[model samples]
Target: MFNEAVTQGDDPGAAAAAHAHGILPSADFCEVVLEEPKADSHGDLSTNMAMQMAKTQRMAPRKIAEALIAHLDDKTGMIAQTEIAGPGFINFFIKPAAWHPVLTAIHDQDGDYGRCDLGKGMRIQIEFVSSNPTGPLHVGHGRGAAVGDSTANILKFCGYDVQKEYYINDSGRQIQTLGLSVYLRGRELIGKTVDFPETCYQGAYIRDLAAELLARDGQELFEKDEAAAIMPCARYAAEKITRGMRADLVDFGVTFDCWFSEQSLYDAGKVAADIRYFREKGLIYENDNALWFKTSDFGDEKDRVVVRQNGQTTYFASDITYHKDKFERGFQKVIDVWGADHHGYIPRMRAAVEACGYRREQFDVLLVQLVNLLRAGQPVAMSTRAGEFVTLADVVKEVGRDAARFIFLTRHYDSPLDFDLELAKQKTNDNPVYYVQYVHARIASIYRKAEANGMDLGGFSTDDLTALSTPEDVALIKALARYPEAVALAGAAMEPHRITYYLMTLAAAFHTYYNRHRVLCEDDLRLTRARLHLITAVQKVIRNGLALLGVSAPDAM
Candidate 1:
């Protein structure tokens, strides 16, 4: 709707004025005015380009604002009013007509309402939930999985060629610990009283793996030399845990396109080859019995070791190869979703990418903070030692995958999320998943009831959406119009939680409309049909949003 104003030679954002004034010019820039919402004083969106350029151009801000305003088409329908407020800050009052077209567009496009050509099909890789294959995913891993999965979905909707990946840590010390843990448990199961080390896994799943091994191979596996058998046992345990982890994620409705292995980097000599590249480029040097990369030069706290004195690669070493491998696959952008506890690792990894000759900005990191699972009002403590840490599968079975995914993403990725078991299981407003699904099911109910009444809505074209002019109707349409913007913002910012919040707000507006007014009133067919059009659009958005979160959008509760 606002595009008409731009096409009419009105103030076309800051870029045009900047170019005429011999200032920095960029086609990518837009002049946005932040005006009060006419209801809230917190200005809907604020930009200070005019004020910033006043001194550089040797002109007063108010004068510059007047010139910019002259170019702005007064016929811009989205702007009910535009005024210079507070030292050249242009504020705009978005007109209701500006929100009306959204309803028609939604009815015309259906579920594809929010998709845009913003990315122009740029290839992007998103790697997340690369948790070690030593145990089931904890709550921390759940957050990353939700964020990464939703992010990829949003990017795909925005016309990006997105590939979702999960990196497996199969060649690490954690795998060794898992092997020893399984072997020790196997020894106990076979009538040996070996002391089980506390450092090994004590989860019941490990015992189950040991049981499976016992059932399949008997005690022959453990009869071999300890050192000789440890690696094989660990490999077996890792495979079992990895399989279980995959099943758990699938149960949670999460799937990845690739499961890249850390072992592959070693098997292919990719890590060694990358280290040699750094060595040849003088990006790495030996100091104090350690092979250190010049990470400090690239913005790390200091230099980091690629290889330890014992001739083993560090975690950072495998990571360099992993990142390089991702870039070499021809993805223009790589996004990593990690638990916030690993925030410190970002700078180093970013530095490694730059040192390896890739653009530092090519790598994006989304730090998903912790989730505190709650069962009533109390915190749910997780412990692997007690064999009581909640698995992703357990959460899915308890509250369901749709509920699990939505609740996990209900908060901003940077903010701490509280997942209440009781609330998630509730069918009312306490559960956002149910609320959104209720709207979808209600729309289906309308369609069924209308069909039974011999009312053919398929013949009703959306070209007559102007019939929907009530305050609530317009409000609902406004929410529908924001879908594309919401999607674009979420993709650009790498924030999937925005969609969760949008669904909740949209669902609330829908339920409120449902409670107050009937969509199939016999005497009001025109308004009823129009409202159905809006409801149908709402259903598409709710279903699409839920799918992005790896949640199910059921037609019936």
Candidate 2:
């Protein structure tokens, strides 16, 4: 794309580049902006510094651009040409050979090529998929799992001290309900006619737990009293369901660094301590026999009750104290990925964090929208059976872990996604995961086929990269070079789905190039080596992209 143009300081990219040219625009030109052009024909990179310097220099914008271009060198053989275009925009065209070193960088870095020191190793804790330990993880939880897990992987890739955590709601009324659900089910199995309350959990898993409870403890559980037995039953059911949740996450390729227990906060009296600290700050007040947190003054919609008249602490109160504990553990940043339904809750949580003396930006809640699972372009009814909803385990079992993870990341976390289970199951190009993974498999096939024919590529070397002159070859190489930029952008924006789309583009370019030309050149050894080296870089980048999404890059379909 270079017509042969001759081409940092903390001060903006345009100013730094201008300083390199020795023709400083006006002293007043303090700010500068640089961006990659939308169209390659415009140039590889563009800057509008001329417009920025116009009023200060009192010169025509185009004249300033021309003067700047006149002093600019060919960026040490990287920039082949520079031109002044629309409204004094300076565009620089980079030579093909300059891009060649990106391939070399990929070769040297390999797995670590797309990584950067963006986070600079700051401690970040991401708590997600903390579904109550009352039922199996349903499809709704699956979306948050994918978003959170992939996000953690990305932050880690970007050089952050990242920890993935799952919070277990092992306290409060829910745990009691789980125990009651299991207890009533146990009575039914023991031939005791008991009316199950409508408020109890209706999942079939609870019945299974109840049957196990009855088999183990028998009438002795009821011999003393239901009150005496309910506590143990609650603990048992919570443990069982939590175990199943962990298993499901493991199956889905998600493993948390910690399983935080809500009960632990209460056990250690952390909530009471946090409340007392707030009271000392004169932020907590007793009203109508309940302890109240004046969150309204801190930007919340209204004041919230931290403790009820009966002395039971609210979930909000415990969560506030839990966040305080998170910061005390030395996490520089705390990110909680919650459901979109909690959008209104963000204000209250932020207010609480601020009232606790932490900056508002220190705590962030990533609200993940709902996912609608579809089959053959129609909605799959996700109603319950035996009190259990259609679970995430069912979806993962049908389409596979890789497909489930990849498809779930095809859109941003905030956007609604209609997951087509049928499309995800397909082996065709319509299935994006299969399409991208196939590129890796195809490259592997090229090497295997070449080696089988006694046309070994030997070791990859780029001494004869000049053989790569075709448009398809150049496009594929260019696409390969964009992997790091894509990764940086995606990680910086916290949009992991962007990486999936980037891989698809790379795969398509590689596929197009492969169909047009051949890699194994029997007559030309240099051409063969060059193509092999290029395709090897392509394979590495594809693998890198796939790895970021927590999906596998298979060598064979």
Candidate 3:
């Protein structure tokens, strides 16, 4: 919304450039991008139009910037000053009145202020944390859960028809391993001596499931051969673990529109059909008594086996069918979130998508790197095969849902995260969640104080809005104003960490302003009302952003 001010009122930059050069409007400029300067000394807003025209115009950027500023006069009345900065960057200092409109927008839009129509009505499906239903979700899955759920929320806020989904990997070798694990544990329940294998799951849930199966199925499960009983055990263990995963995700503030079953793909013969289509398209070949996808042709390291010599399909085959099913469901775009270890799968996945008659752009993969759970300063131990990782439920229980989510997303998806458990639980500035939430709580405390002091909370005068002209005040407002742009950028790039970064910046500015200035002064009524309205807007924006990240903006600590 703040960025809209640059183009809506009048041709702010383009008209100025056209008038200066006597060329067509926006003709000489490739693209006029406006952003706040990192340093306050560089003016309020800076654009690179001069550098854009330098190569084509055959002139120094400094000369072009000087020419652009010469034509910018009081025609807009918005720019207070204009100058050419280093390397011919045109920077504009807008009058304080220019930021007043942002307050009106924030007040009027409320919860809807930062929402945009960037995605229009396009349908998008996001699949994340589709971990095989073998054990509880660990902290790695926690990062994916936060990132995926927040990304879906951001896209929906930006007006996309977004569908959040979790694919159940219930039909594979892993599920069979879960069955063997349960089967072995079930015999132990019957007072029979059984040896556990390194390949089988070692989680406590396996013993729990064994107890349940022993009570439900009785000795009947043991009466049948392991081959005949493996299917039932696999089916039962998958359902139990999947239900636990669903419950845990719900508790973590994540929900899915669909709990897609991988077994359903096989039961419906879609996997076979997809293989036939690949065969017909000449995308598959036979080698060493196995069916292989021509993935090497698509820049993969080597050809991949879709069907082994034993006639069982690989996980990649099922994934292709799953994606094909996603596109056939009328989704225009499909996004899958997987761990960074799966980065090598991107090329073949794109190739499969192209073979399914969709462009490469229609499908995307977001690779989430590992999260190193840290207690104090040391690494927390985790053993996936032993089912000994600190579960998402454990993290949520320890730090609260809001703190867990906020800390999980404090870093970008591709970057490795060192999740400091102690810091996440800290109620101090060292904790980002605490810092940002305190800004909101402080604003609420001001409102309570305002009512007690009989201060006007109904409306504020825009004339007094300029009374908040201190550098910290302006910085706080600017941070809040850039929310819409942050949402758009994060959604378009699938980065939820941007929201966390913005919230921290806004919180720091608000904290600085609160410490330095007074919100409800005894002597200055107009200034009091002006700053009250300002902080109220900040509270609204922080809530809006926190809502997207699935975190709470508390009225009090």
Estimate the lDDT of model 3: 0.86
Per-model lDDT: 0.80, 0.85, 0.86
| TM-score for each model | 0.86, 0.92, 0.92
Off by over 4 Å in 3: 1-33, 48-66
The candidates, ranked best first by TM-score, are 2, 3, 1
| Ranking according to lDDT, highest score first | 3, 2, 1
Q: Which runs of model 1 end up more than 4 angstroms from their true locations?
A: 1-98, 385-387, 456-464
**Least lDDT summed over 10 consecutive residues: which range in candidate 3?**
1-10
Q: What are the RMSD figures for all models against the true structure?
A: 5.8, 4.5, 4.7
Backbone clash pairs for candidate 1 read 10-71, 11-71, 11-72, 13-31, 34-45, 179-234
Candidate 1 global TM-score: 0.86
User: 212-324, model 1: which lDDT tens digit per residue?
Assistant: 99898989987776777778888988888889889988877778899999999999989999888889899999988889999999999999999999888899999998998
Candidate 1 vs candidate 3: the TM-score winner is: 3
- Counting clashing residue pairs in each candidate, in order, gives 6, 11, 0
Write model 2 residue lDDT over 1-557, tens digit each, in one string. 21123221223435445444534434455355668788888877799988887776555778768766775644376777788999999998777776778788889999999899999999999999999998889988999999999999988999899999999999999898887778777877777888988788877788889878778877667444677778899999899888999999999999999999999999999999988988898899999999999999899999999999999999998999888889989999999999999999899899998997899999988889999889999988765544746689999999999999999998889999889999999999999999999999999998899888898566656668877776667677778878888888887888889898899889889888888988888999789999888998999998988888889999999
**Number of the top TM-score candidate:** 2
Q: Residue by residue across 405-495, what tens digits does model 3's lDDT show?
A: 9988999899999998998999999998999999899999988988898865555678888897777777778878899999999988989
Best of the candidates, lDDT: 3
TM-score for candidate 3, please give it. Answer: 0.92
